[model samples]
Every structure is written in structure tokens, then in C-alpha cells.
Target chain A: MSKFLLATLLLHIPLYIYPILRLCYWAESPLWLTLLIFIPLVSSQYMSRFYLRKKNSVWTKLLRRFADFYLGVSPVLLISTLLAEIFVGFHMVTFGTAVTSVIAITVILGIVATMAALSPMVKTITLSSGKLTAPVRFVQITDVHIGSRKPAFLDRVVHIVNELKPDFLCITGDLIDGQGVSEDDLKSFKSVVGPIYFTIGNHEKYEGVEAIARRLENLGVKVLRNAETHFTKELQVIGIDDMDDANQVAVQLEKQTLDKDAFVLLLYHRPRGLKAAADAGVDLMLSGHTHNGQIMPFNLVVNRVFDMIKGLYEHAETKLYVSQGTGTWGPIMRLGTRSEITLFEISPAQESLFPSR
Target chain B: MSWLDEGADVRSTSLTEEFTIDLYRETYQDRFIPLFVVESSGRLRVVTDKADIPADCKIISLIKSDNI
Candidate 1:
């Protein structure tokens, strides 16, 4: 067996098989009925893993969607079952009540979680910029995962961002994760008002970045590949490619001779290198990719992975804001987090005037 | 395969800590699922974990030294 399958199997013994055994015991099911449940339960993981990796047909896509939705619902089911089991253990509920309650709780919470994933809220962040004479407004939407998310979702994001009327849009990374997602699927990006600047995420690398970047460029996105551009006389925007290295922010910043007079705005995909950006005199950095754990206990895991998962973090002179992302990745549900489109309104700082003058 | 990617990939190794198992799809090379988003902060605050952060930030991780 592949390592992934093996690892998945080991994990599922505790996560899936144990839960099934408990449920079967609670209901006193026949061996055949137990087998029926086991087959589909065991197969869901492998089916999703194998089907959605490289290419996709209409059926594979449908299967992927089912698996994705199940992915979201499974967590809810597990948690509900866990809660019911706890109640039963405490003698507060009977096994039959526990089972029914688990189903009811899963259905309700599952729907709620799915709704949370479907809706993307507009989050406004205001900061004091050191270089700008006026407030610069821009919207940031990252990890949209256009593959799992349809283009209509992008259309909704664009419509919302356009309503905000920001100066420009910034996409940090993970814009596409599916090979099946085509350029036409991403046509709504052109409808977003103002310029859209992007850096490739890890998912982009997986989905053939060269092709994805080209598609984004065709749709009028400025794909910044370890590159920089002058947004205005007082603002310099630097885009760093999401390198598979620890000090991507530091290494990329070292290569750029930032304009002393302009506010240095850095767009990186992952949240790291804050001290590096600050040491290099970066004024502000924007990022996404953590998705703030994208779920409940998973957030706990993500917390272990990233130092700054969400919101603003300041280090010396640099400030970083990590977006919660604008779209869902899998299962199309958020247990403890909401999807967001971040709008940043940066006004000039009085302290910044001293250096510029 | 996910473990290999996480163990070997410099990015994954550096980005995450040990014992972090992924339950969701990664979709890199036909990987599994990724779901949920636990939002943080009470408004757009300057949340800090400066005390918990390690001092020496530049830790270069390679899965295997000989792999090209």
C-alpha cells in the first residue's frame, strides 16, 4: 500500500472503524449490514483520493463533489457521535437516544457548517501606511480554490469587491487546485474592478502553475513571480513567489532594493518571515494559505503549523495581515471559521512623513 | 505520500510542526480533503505570539540530503 493509504488507514481505524463499530453495537446490526456500512465508509477516503488528483471527467467530478461534501459532513457526524457517546457514557442519555441525537445534531450542524462555507463575508481592515499621502484601499482574496469552488463563487467575490470599490485586488495564493478548472471557468476575474495582483500558492504548483499563471494573466491578473512593481509614486508593491523553502520572504526581500520614499507592500502566500520583512524595512505584508485551520480541531493543528494563522501581526516596522480566504477547499463547510474577502484601507502615517521629506 | 511530501518538502517541514496529521484533501498529487476554517481574533487586532516564537527563525529543512 502507498504510504498515504497506509497512514490514512491507520488513522481511519480510530476515526472511522471505531465509530462504525460503536454505532453497529448500539443498533445490534447484522454482519451483512455492518459490511454494507464498512464498504462505503472505508471507500470514501480512497475514492476521493484517487479520483480528484490528476484529471477529471464528468463522473469523477461528480464523485469528487460527493466526496467533498461528505468530507464536511463526516466531521460533523464524528463530532456528533462523539458527543452522543459522551452523553451515553455519563448515563444522561440512552444508546437509542444517543444515536438519534447524533443524527439530528449532525444534520443541523452539518447544514450550518455548509452555509458558513458558502457565504463569504467582506472584512474591512484599516491601517496607517507610512508612505501614502492618501488612504489606499484594496481588497485581498486568497485560497479561493477555484477548482473546488465554481466560477460563480468567483463572480460573487468580484461583485462584492467591486461594490467595495477598492483601489486594487490582491490574491496571495492557492487560487486554483484542480487540473479540470479551465480558463473559461475563471472568466469572472476580469469583471473585478481595478487591477488584480497575484502570487502562486502551493496548489498552483500542483495544478501546473505555468499554465495556471498564463490563464490568470490572460484574464488580466498580474502574476508576480519574485517580482516587484511601482503601484504609485509613494507605494511599491512586491510579489514573492511561494517558494518551497523556510525563508522565502527573507530571501525574496533581500533581492529587492526597495524604494526608500515609497511604502513597501509585500504579498506572500504563506504567513512567515515577518521579522525578515521588518528587518528588510517592509511596511506591510499580506498573506493567506492557513485558512485559520479551516475547521475546528483542524485549526488546532494549523496553529501548530503556522505562528500567525490569521489577523494582523507586527514585527519591528513590518505589519502582516493573513486572510481567512474567500472560498472553501473541501467538504464545503466551516465548523468554527467563516470565509472572508478582506478589504484593507491604509492611510498615511504622520511618522512616515519624516522619512519621506 | 502525504507524509513523504510533508517529510521531504522543505516548505511543509518548515511551515508545520510534528504530529500534525491532515484529515482533508491536499490535491497536490491526487491527495485527500481540506476543510473548515477556524477564524481568529476579535476584530482586526494585532494578535501576537511573540513569546512562543523561536528566536532562530532560519531553519533550512530538506527531506533527504541526496535527493535532487
Candidate 2:
């Protein structure tokens, strides 16, 4: 049992410890209190089982599950605690001061989680039609992980998209966990929306990029694969595959005869190198790999990972819009960040409908 | 009256022959539906709404509702 406990501890530690330590830093707290809090939190599971011996009600059953699960969360807490200890100790900090630091870290994490849950997140961005008389309307929906265990989530999302009635829809990637998706699941995706345009994300690449691309194409989705399409006389849309294939993106761009005034949009799944995209003279870029750090403390860790994590950013003349994604990854619960569908009306500043105008 | 008089009171002249045929076909669906028109008679006024329509013929206002 002890060996099993040690193995379990080792297994779960990395998942929680690295993220908490990297992202959180508490301003003020006593080290002893932080360590003491973990003791009760860890034992809460056993205590709840003991308490359940005397009760037989729905509330008792629910409380027991909560206790078991939350107590299970102690492994994560333990990892985070040890990380705080190691960091402060390495800096030659006193043992008593270490507990304060850990407590402060937890408080900061709690605050971040709370702030994320409370933030007025963007729910749906709709592009009202007739606003622009452009021949082709390209709508980009990025980071929709539809394989979440969450119920009726995709149905509601598709309903929203149908209401908008865009002429063409583009999916920037991370369609599924890739691990969980089956052949039949991919088939169901075909009926979810009208014709779709897709580009693979790192997750898709992980699950055999070529196979996923071929399967999606078979379902009527055009996989851009560093390809360019002259969507309209005034616009040229290019999909610079994912980050790993940056060279392919450059090669494809070289083949296209890009006009200075043409509306150019690039869908690169990861937001790693915005400079390359800007240098490539991409007018607008769409990406959604970050999920903006799906969890609470993870958001801060993710914030540090990339320059443009979420929202519309202007770099010189290029506009980069990183959506938070339309679906949750694991646990089927989005504590901090809400899923989003971003719609943009790409038009010139003036009323010149014709490119010549 | 010349052959031009037959369509002189038409409100608008559709450039395409297909569109003109379709418009006339649409009138057959509902006989009560009005089709009043006033075409250009060498600077002649174009009767568009029911108010300017000749009482003998039914008049259909292009404005279905003022809210639109």
C-alpha cells in the first residue's frame, strides 16, 4: 500500500506541481499554516467516509463524493506544497517562512480561479450580415474540442452558428482530444455544420496528422495544408499549417501572388511566432491552441508560454485574433475560461466595396 | 396608342426578359393581389405606390410595412 501510494504520488505530482509552482506566487502567508492546511485537506476523504457511516440521504451521498474527490485533489496539493518548499529551501529560506510562502501561493491560486470564474468572458461574437457586401464571408471557429463529456454542449454551439448563417466557416483546429475521437465521431462532425475549412493543431498532429487531414477532407472539409485560395477578387485566404510546419507555410506564401490591398488571413494553430506571421505580411491571423490556459493557475502559466494567448491584437498592419476555444478539454468543466466563437467583419476603413475603389 | 402604351403605365422595366416573365407569373398566384405600375413616358411620372395608382387597376405598394 505504501509503495502504491508512493507510485500514485509520483504519477500525479507532475500534473499539478509544475503548473502551480510556475504560475503562482503568494504575497503574504505563514509557512506553518500552509503545511498544516494540507494535513486536514488530505485526511478529509477518510473523515468523510467515517462521517457517512451514520447518514443515509442524498445529501450525505453527494457530500461523500465531494469529500472523496476533493480529498483526491490533495495529491495535487501535496505536489504544489513540496514544490513551494523546494523553491524556498533552495533560496536558503527559513523552514518557518516556507509555510507562509506556500499558503500565500494557494491564496493567490484561489484568487486567480475566482477571478477567472467571475470575469465577463466573451460568449459569442456575431458578424451581422449586410454590414459588408463582400462576395465571400469567411467565419473562423477555432479550438472546438467537441469530445468533452459535457452534455448538449456541441448542440448549443451548433445552434449558435446556424443562427449566424455565415457563408463559409473555417475551423482553425484542435477539433477533438484526438485520443478520444473515433472514426464514427469524425463522421458525426460532418453534419454538425455546413461545409467547413480546417487546419490541424498540435493535438491533431499528435494523433497522426496525415490520417486526420485525410479523414476530415473525406468529410468535405478542405484541409489547407499550407495552401492558398483566392476566396474573392479583393481577398486571399492562406492557411499556414501548424507551428511545426512553419517552412511549408513560407513555401506556400512564396507561390501566391499577394496583392498589397488584398485581405489576407492566415490560420496557424499555435500562437508561438507572431513575428514570422507579421513578416509574412499576413493581414489577419487566427489561432486557438492555448485554450488560454484551460484551468485557473494554468492560465498564468499559459500567459507566460506565448505572446498572444487570447483576444484581438494588432501588430503593425497585421491583426491576430486568438480565440479561447469553443470546448473544454478535460474534466468537462471550465472553471476559469468560457468557450468562445469569434466572428469578425473584415472590411476596409472606407465604404469602397469594389477593390478598385 | 402605340404598342409602347401597353406597358407605358408599368412602374419599372426589368432589364432581363426572364425576370419580367417571372414577375407576371407571380401575379397569377393571387388575383386579388394588386399590380399597378407607371413607366417613364418621356419624362412621365412613375406611379410607384397605391396613392398614385389609377383607380381602375389594383395597386400594390412596394413598402409592405413602414417598419421595414
lDDT, candidate 2, A1-357, per-residue tens = 699577646644454443333333342335666555444544454455455534646675565545533433333355557776677768876544665665565555545543443222334332222223454445666666644322245445555665666655778887754343555555544454444657777667656665665556545465555545444546555665565644645554554445556666677787755566677787777888887876655678788867878887877766678888776554333445766776665544554577772
Q: State the local distance difference test value for candidate 1.
A: 0.72
- The numbered model that scores best in TM-score is 1
TM-score of each: 0.79, 0.53
Q: DockQ for each candidate?
A: 0.02, 0.01
Predicted model with the maximum lDDT: 1
Give the TM-score comparing model 2 with the true structure, all chains together.
0.53
**Which digits, one per residue and each the tens of the lDDT, describe model 1 over residues A155-205?**
888889889998888999998987678878887777776667788898988
Output the number of the DockQ-best candidate: 1
Cα-based lDDT at residue A124, candidate 1: 88
What DockQ number belongs to candidate 2? 0.01
**Residue A160 in model 2: lDDT:** 65
Clashing residue pairs in candidate 2 are: A29-A100, A30-A99, A30-A100, A31-A99, A31-A100, B9-B37, B10-B38, B10-B39, B11-B37, B11-B38
